[model samples]
Target chain A: MANADRIAGSDVFRPNLTGRHATGRFWQTAFLGATTVGILGLILLMLNIVNNAFGLVAYADGEDYLKYSPIPVEQLATSDLVVLLTNELSTGAINKLNAEQPLDTRSRSDLLALVFERILDREVVASSTLAEAVFNRQAFEADALAKNPDARFVFKSWVTTDFLTVPMSSQALFAGVRTAILGSLMLIGLTIAIALPIGTGAAIYLQEYADKSLINRIIETNIYNLAGVPSIVYGMLGLAVFVRVLEPLTSGAMFGATDTNGRTILSAALTMALLVLPVIIVNAQEALKAVPDSLRQAAYGVGATRWQTIWHHVLPQAIPGVLTGSILAVSRAIGETAPLIVIGASTFITADPSGPFSGFTALPIQIYNWTVQPQAEFRNLAGAAILVLLVLLLTLNASAIILRNRLSARRAN
Target chain B: MTQALSSLPVTDPQDRHVDWAARLRRKPRPVETVVQGLLFLCGAISILTTLGILLVLGNESLAFFTDPEVNVFEFFTGTHWQPQTGDFGVWPLVNATLMTSAIAMVVAMPLGIFAAIYLSEYAAPRAKAILKPTLEILAGIPTVVFGFFALTFITPLLRSIFGEDTVQIYNNASAGLVMGLMIVPLIASMSEDALSAVPRTLREGAYGLGATKLETTVQVVLPAALSGLVAAFIIGVSRAVGETMIVAIAAGATSQLTFNPFEAAETITGHIARISGGDLSYGSLDYTSLFALALTLFVITLGLNLVSRWLVNRFREQYD
Candidate 1:
């Protein structure tokens, strides 16, 4: 220690301290800036969607509804609303809607929304984004009044509880994502059901049973390559296979459907299942590979056969991992737009999917259709639907993450 | 239960034999063989899916080529892509796809690399755990949402800043920018893996020579991880090329042969989507054209993916 102190006092040589500090500081700032760019992009995305979801809308009820209503609009009873709609709408329009789905089976709110959209033709005269409504409220009111003198202004949220329950419509004010949500749920359910067992089985064969042969290597490589294939390619596969070649089954023609053909929930679900299969297999392989050999040895030591050991011990240990993987795949499938679009998901279907063979549209398709509309309010509707999709996606992801974490925590003990 | 079992008298040897026989009798004779066959079938499904994709794409694409109206030479060399009439030139669509992907790479590469450096080298463990998932969540967001964001939010911001004349209502720049954001996490996570994989001994060696932290990271670690970084970049490029919803919704669906990012241009994926959504009948030339475009996309992405996986494997081998 005395010798080191003596050498420090002598100060034989020194590095360029200031230049080094400056370089370190500069790099630190640069990296921090990069992280901020990503984080800011996420924040901006959320803000942009949230901002459009709420705003002031100036709506004008159809001329006939305004003239013939006996009482105020909001206070009208459900039966009275139905009668008003029946009286106001053309019989052809009412029949067409009923043929699509019976109006009597619809909820009261749905009926009311239908009354406004079909019979009353409630029109958005002028709409301001959330920012404009917040900062320039009086200006917006004046502009809206100038545009339509009789139009009533209201602070409306595009993403309401009612939004989740009502079906799609032409009028932006009455459009909802209930049908789309139901279709998405059905697709997710079918995808998980089809993909989980097949994917895990493949993983087990590759990890536990397969010998290092040429065919095995080829299959293994093919799985990796398929995982990187663009989603749109899978769409083409679905179109050709499920929608075309197997149309008799996918379209329910085998089950006696006469009109609908190929563009059914079954085709979309099958496509999504294939699209997520590689993902599930890859994840399951990783999870299965993580299991210690000692566990297998112990099972063998107890005179258990390979399948018995796998089913009783290894499979139980791998369940949480498999579930985590399935959840991730579900999230991917539910949000997938390209494949479903290619496989002919309807852009404007109002009827909920009643069976696997039923024609369907998903949330992403709904959002896409609304965004392309000429009406500014449809963009808000798109934003609202995006919020719904995000919430759904996050809830699924959160549950899976929480489950995986708890399982891993238990394993740590 | 353990105490009661221990307190019981030992069972007779014959009873144990009977129990073993009973268990053996109960076992299904064909269960294991059936399960193994089932697993083999499951594994074969992935291979069959690949063949099916190839067959489907090739079958329809050949049909598209053999049609009397579609000249094979014009399909590749011709610049215009007016499939509604008779012009099936794919170059314009390819050009637009490349332009959007190029812009996305421009936005993503530097930011992704630096973010990776920060996460791998600079972040404390707690910060890293939080930041990593946040980035992943950003990645997990549906691309359709990004399309709406690009159209409603970004284009307006650009218009206000650059004038309405410069930024169109639907242009490639907004879509490309948001697509870049969508892929930033992908690139960041992959590159972070590469950066963190650099041996600690190398960093220590540089530090021992009086090198600064920045000097060691940039000079020693980054150079060693270059192959992995290139792999990451290539993967990002492939992802940007295949991206559909953002370009379809935000970039106008007009098939214009222009190099301008500010102008409206349609990508190959966008063109397929727009065309397929129409009322074209089954077996029509227009509908068949969708398959041809998808074939092109499939081939391009497959090649890019092969190269990326090769590079990644090479990188891993080097470290191992």
Candidate 2:
């Protein structure tokens, strides 16, 4: 008994005591390092984006404008800016602009954008990445002035209210994510509309109706596999089926379509719906399965049919779960650009998506297009767009999480 | 099955004759049959979607192979890929795809496993709740954002560290690094589920044998959860392979069959995106080749997913 007691307490009984302890400590530190990396990466990513979104930019007005304007470009009001464009731009240029949309009919802001883009040809002469603009503003300003003596510097937050409202422009200063945001919203709405019912129905059938048969099992396996398929593959399907084969329907040609030859919001939305359907089905099935067998039996004991029991009891309980899952899936769909690119989502579109059949460009696609541009200012624009995208994603996810928690708490009570 | 059927009201022959209304009421409802049929139709649509994907891919891929310009033998054996120039070689794109995925796996696999271990074995409940959601938020960030981050932030940082000569402006390494960060949440969460699924009894036994927390976690728990860890790894690989935006935007769209991580190289997805984004005429060889590349990607991801599912099922049966 003494020996046993000694063995329990002794280092000898703890085989490889020093060795295991040392290794364990090493691993613990390693694990800590690994975990910290994720947090650090997130911090770095946010900082990087925020830094680019707000900074000092030096803008050089068109050399021709400098010749005509008595005052510096920065001091000019919106009205003066438009007047300057009319006087400075050649008659042919004005005619071309008028042909697209008459200057007089254009909104004040839109005319201003045109002035900056076509007449003034505003260019970012020199810019700093996020950090330099923040920490060494004097140095950045001096550098910008030296590079372009005529240019004016201003402190700007790229993600302003105006940035959210304006349409795309060749000029970095005038370009905005308005059209992209509208397209994304429309696409997401359509995706949810199409995917929700079918995914939920499939899940209900799998969990509540189907028995453990070979066919059911195969269906289950197929869904699991579908979820794993590369999203780009789905893009191919959309291109073929929705964009080409069913072009008349997708493009609304069958319903008096005018401009589009497929590659419409409807096609993109259907593709996204297909992309997210497996996720919804799998998640909905899990939520359905979580509903107790006892609950179903109790309903049956009261002479409720399977459909009635599911519709009245199981579905209500599972709604929150299904909703939360669908939100995350939609978030995934919103972020998806590759498949959209494959199916011919426009890289640059100024007009907001008017309807499901309208040609579109989403936030992710806009961000992608901007990132590829050689100009440094577009990167800043991409950063601002990224912030918008992140906000939209977080809001959706948070709402879903809150709803799920509340529902579950109520159920427990 | 009988137990499920037993709940419906039953009618005796004598009773039915005396009360015809009761007998008619006892019959199965038409609404039930209609609803079941509708639900079954819904389930069948998923199968149909898969078939559509396969048929679309297979049909176009066949067209691509049959095109005289697209040499099937050369597609696999050749090293260069220039669809416009009619080079038609696919291995260069394949190599780049592998290289990027390899770098991503290297970064994500160990970091993710260690993070999962820490979360499962060491993190406090509050910490777990906070950290898990935080990780999920990371996952929720759009891939486009990551692509931009890779381009503006990661690439510049890498250039500063390694000097301008080694790190090109649009290098695969930077893209791969950001892609890894994008995938870390996926790997960690899946791995956490696997690690947490390890039975407490096994852990306790290890402790009883005078093992330290680290020893039990590393040796006993990890081994017990090996299949799950493997599944997580496979899933990670699939995600890395399927990723598009990061490579398309940040990584170079130029195709080269080089092993260097810092060099500009195009991936299969990137190649397809670049070509497809342009105005390619319908029925062009370039158009069909896009489908061929997509088919390859689909098959690879599909195979990985199946293996992952099989492994998960195998381990689950053992434990249950």
Candidate 3:
């Protein structure tokens, strides 16, 4: 016991003197703190988007009734239902209600909007009070009397076929993404058509033909530079070249306009093609470069002509790579909005594009337009549109991944 | 056989040449020459496209420079970007672009480098496998989503913490922050490859000397991977410069040349976005100015990418 006390009382009782330990602890904590902050920032960003996009829906002051039910005609005992219906309907004449439903005074003005919304297309409602009676007594009365009123009852699915069918409207409840989707599809198709051949041809020439001269070195440098050029620069180029220089041809033949303001779908698509062309060419060249020289030599050893060797052997071997690059380029084109918007893609396109040169709106532009609206419903519409854009982008990316995997597997084999 | 050959050579010179030519035709030709030619042509065309892009951009910019309104000094120094008012100073836009890109580098470089170090030297195979793909998914997400995320989410969060006064409805910080997140995977992936390229023998030597793992990584591996790390940072900067939608949506378009991150400012590309949307006539100074801006952006980013390529190539050579 005395020895133990002596040992404890000796150097072991001295203050901790390992300065390195303290420094190590401090550094570790700092590193952990930084990493935690980064991850937290990412989480906070995602949660913020969800909160704004998914929280309680808000309706405009005058349009709040769209979520409620219409008044019941049966509650008006003595008065003629037809006269009462006409009187109640005229109250909000500016609301664009149909004359089909019989007058129901008990329903709030907001609930009446829903009744008119449901009956506007019904032909039987045009002549018969029965159409109004059924809707008025059941939906209008029940919705109006519910104790704890909710807006979800009138909630429209933003992912429905109608979302891709109907045109956009100021009424957030009726607004759909049909025009934007169509525009995006058209733009993607046009971009592929324009970018694929030029990009592929450039890759082919670079990998299959160029001499190892100073000129080739310069070209290589230039290609790298072009790839690094900002996308908005391409937008400016599109505005100048396609919209201005070729306006006579583009606007005249495609958009039926003579002025330079003819920012047709073709102009936007062409601009995007230019934006992604360098990417495709670079990727394609890399893929072509990966093809083994042994294969080319083997083909040549068989006394096959150069053209025949490349066509039958080298090209076939490089095709998977080229296709992979093309897929990536197309995906990039689909998500691009800045160049398109810069080249004058319409923000308020109502009709779906019918041809390559028609004026159109893209998904991103639609989201931007919706986000700027004064009403809360418009914000919801923007969220729904964003979801659509995300899904489309994912689909494109997935296909590219599948293609890349397949190519790699083939190469492995 | 010798006597016959001698007799044939004794005949007319033209007849002998014809006979030699026929024999040469019978022999198999070198088809590899043709294949080499084709490959050469492919390389040439790739070069041609690059030339075409430069020619197009250069010609348009030259046309823009001829206009008296586009004074180079004013464009580089002037603070206001009110193109409608004929005030075309590019300083404010440049400031915004530089400020956001700087902030993004600050956020991305350290985290990405650390993550790369962890993956290469510290993490198990299972952890690496899971982390790599998750990071790639982060990279693959569309920039539009990032923009939406910045505008809707990042901005509001900044508002709550710093108060609305500290952050604008559209501020540079949110855009820069999101951009950094977007680029982290890029830096991490590339830097990991660079760090892994360091010879294991060097690491083992450090261990033999009784150095700790952290010490070996910092003192040996990091220095060895310096060239590659620099390349990654430059590439990250190039990406930040070319980035459009995030800044356009999240960073406001005021064009005030101040250094304040809270202010709504325009970028060179952002100015192009604004001007291109207007009704500027073809060949007008405004329209031509867009091309000049494009050329400037092209030159800057191109320089950055070349430097990055050079560094990466050097790093590869050192080990190879």
* lDDT against the true structure, each candidate: 0.87, 0.87, 0.70
* Best of the two (1, 2) by lDDT: 1
Per-residue lDDT tens digits for candidate 1, residues B1-320, read 24634564567664654564465446675877898889988999999999999999999999999999999999889899997689999998999899989888988999899999999989999999888888887888888888888999899988899999998998998889988998899999999999988989889999998688899999999999888899989899899989999999999989989988999999999988888776668788988898999999989988998999898787663544
Off by over 4 Å in 3: A1-53, A60-157, A252-262, A372-375, A403-413, B1-65, B68-70, B314-317
Best candidate, DockQ: 2
**Candidate 2 segments whose C-alpha is farther than 4 A from its true place:** A5-16, A63-115, A402-413, B1-28
- State the local distance difference test value for candidate 1: 0.87
lDDT of 1 at B257: 92
Q: After superposition, how far is residue B11 of candidate 2 from its true place, in Å?
A: 9.7
Model 2 per-residue lDDT tens digits across residues A1-413: 99788876787756666777888889899997898898889999999999888888899876555575776555677677667778878999888778867777777667666666776678888766667777898898888889889878878889987799887877788889999999999999999999999999999999888999998888888888888887888888999899999999999999997979789999999999989999999899989988888888998877677888999999988988898779879889989998888889888888878899999999999998998998878988988998999898888778778988898888889
TM-score of the second chain, each candidate in turn, equals 0.89, 0.91, 0.86
**Candidate 1 Cα errors over 4 Å, as ranges:** A1-15, A64-66, A77-79, A89-114, A402-413, B1-29, B317-320
Candidate 1, residue B262: CA error in Å? 0.3
* Model 3 lDDT per residue over B1-320, tens place: 24534554555755645665565346555665654555555445545545555776788778877677777778777777776788877778778999889988998998788778767877689867866676665676567667777777778778999998788898898889888988887898889899999999889999887566767788998999988899999989998987887887788877887787877787777677766766667677777777777777878888899899888776663643
Clashes of each: 0, 0, 22
Q: Any residue pairs clashing in model 1, and if so which?
A: none
Decide which is better by DockQ, 2 or 3.
2
lDDT of 3 by residue, A1-413 (tens): 99767854677543332443465456555544444455565555455444444333222232343233254332433334334445445566523434323344333433333333432311111110122223444553344335224322232334555566667765555568888999998888888887777777677766677778887778777777767777776776677678777776666564355433458888888788777877888888887898899999998676555667777888778877888788778777877777886788888767678776678898988887776554545655676777788688788867877887887788679
lDDT score of residue B165 within candidate 3: 78
Q: How big is the RMSD of model 1? A: 4.8
* Candidate 3 interface RMSD, angstroms, 1 decimal: 4.5
Instruction: Let me know the TM-score candidate 2 reaches against the reference structure.
Output: 0.92
Q: Score residue A195 of candidate 2 by CA lDDT.
A: 93
